[model samples]
Target: MSLRGKIGAGAIALASTPLILFLGTWEGTGQNIVYGDKLARGLPTVCKGLTEHTSPYPLVIGDFWSDARCAEVESLVIRKGQLALADCLTNQQIGQNTFDALSSHAHNVGTSNTCASRAVGLINAGHLAEGCKALAWAPNGTTPVWAYVTDAAGQKHFVPGLHSRRRAEARLCIQ
Candidate 1:
């Protein structure tokens, strides 16, 4: 039977390892230092893309966190994302790689958007591989989504970094 509701402990544990590594690779550790997100136009962000909104505390410029502290916060954030993701997922018995990829995508985007995403909808409809591909492209299969950054001028620009990350997640999802 397809599992639903909250993600089980075993699945969480299995996905956590690769999810963490994947996040570190894409988000970067930021050397445990807070910096402004250029895409967000000076929004302060810390290790592994932790912003004031997501961080336990309000992030300020130049704030520093130890590596251990960064890891702790990253774990907390990922756990929260996983929980929210579980609520949206109709089938919780997905593979570890797929879970990790979805969790990573949810971490980058918000859980709400991830939940309402075409990828999730496709996954729920049992189109597993298609759902994975939807991470990089829209339903039309050519238009890129989640691969843009808003600038200070309120204009959106395509970001190669985001495209690369999404493609990586899609690859992991299908593995």
Candidate 2:
């Protein structure tokens, strides 16, 4: 093969490596984790963070079920045969706006920078891996903040099982 062709092939291989590895090992589907960072966590907003939107949403990024729904149902859990109860929200604001936010994400799972897009964005940016590696406090709470990530398909995902961010960095280098 020509030298140019070889270089191009090599570049392609390198680019695909992470993606191949990621898709094969991505943990942000179905099973989700929660972190301690509050701000970084899922906030009630338009579908996946859209600037212009309509409708209501439910389910925060981290499985924050709505309080009222929880009360009406007399339980924090909600399941509808095939669909597991996924809307668990804290903070009245998050709870109140969840219906809209989740609906919005449910609205666009494959287009734009909606929730799914944010999930992809975070992963591509290495935030998911980085946060997972930086898990602080074992996700048992007490940590300053916690984080959770919903995948491109709106599956619940998290960066839970945290320790100190510094300690996590040390593990990376030592290993």
Candidate 3:
């Protein structure tokens, strides 16, 4: 099925195959183990980036999740993120690629922030390409915004992995 078809079916089915694959590629399937997120130190994350915020229960170090469990949680998380983002999007006619890119961004950042981002505002204003570019850079187009991670001391620093991911997301959005 095409990505659009999958997305339509995802409304009832929870998650689409392509969306799952895209998130898995970025989030990484850390199967059977729970580990602290270096970026958000002390937070236990597992199974494709499920943290206590996204999980039904608290996650601790040494926690384990079977492959099936991981798949289930990942799908749930993706679906939830998609639904939350959908509420913020005024343009219902957006293409599948744009939707996927926005959903992926919402999954990584929070839906609240993604909804309020300049990218979404630009997209709503019908500036599709500019919106895509805004995913990585600020409106000025030079300074990076979403590519940084905040440390416990409240210092934000550039994260290479996040920068690469945002670039990939922008590419997907413009495609």
* Candidate 1 ranges with C-alpha deviation above 4 Å: 1-6
Candidate 3 has which clashing residue pairs, if any? none
Better of 2 and 3 by TM-score: 3
- Please provide, for model 3 over 55-145, each residue's C-alpha lDDT reduced to its tens digit, 9 standing for 90 to 100: 8767889988889988877777888887777777776557778888888888888889999999999998889999999999888888876
> Per-residue lDDT tens digits of candidate 2, residues 1-175?
4222333454212112332222223212222222222322333332112111321234344454343433232111111100110212111221212222222222222123323333223323545433333222233334433234455566655554322322332233123
Find the 10 residues in a row with the least total lDDT in model 2. Answer: 76-85
> Global lDDT of each model?
0.81, 0.27, 0.81
Worst 10 residues of 1 by lDDT: 1-10
Give the 10-residue window scoring lowest on summed lDDT in candidate 3: 3-12
TM-score of 1: 0.91
lDDT of 3: 0.81
What stretches of model 3 exceed 4 Å from their correct place?
A: 1-14
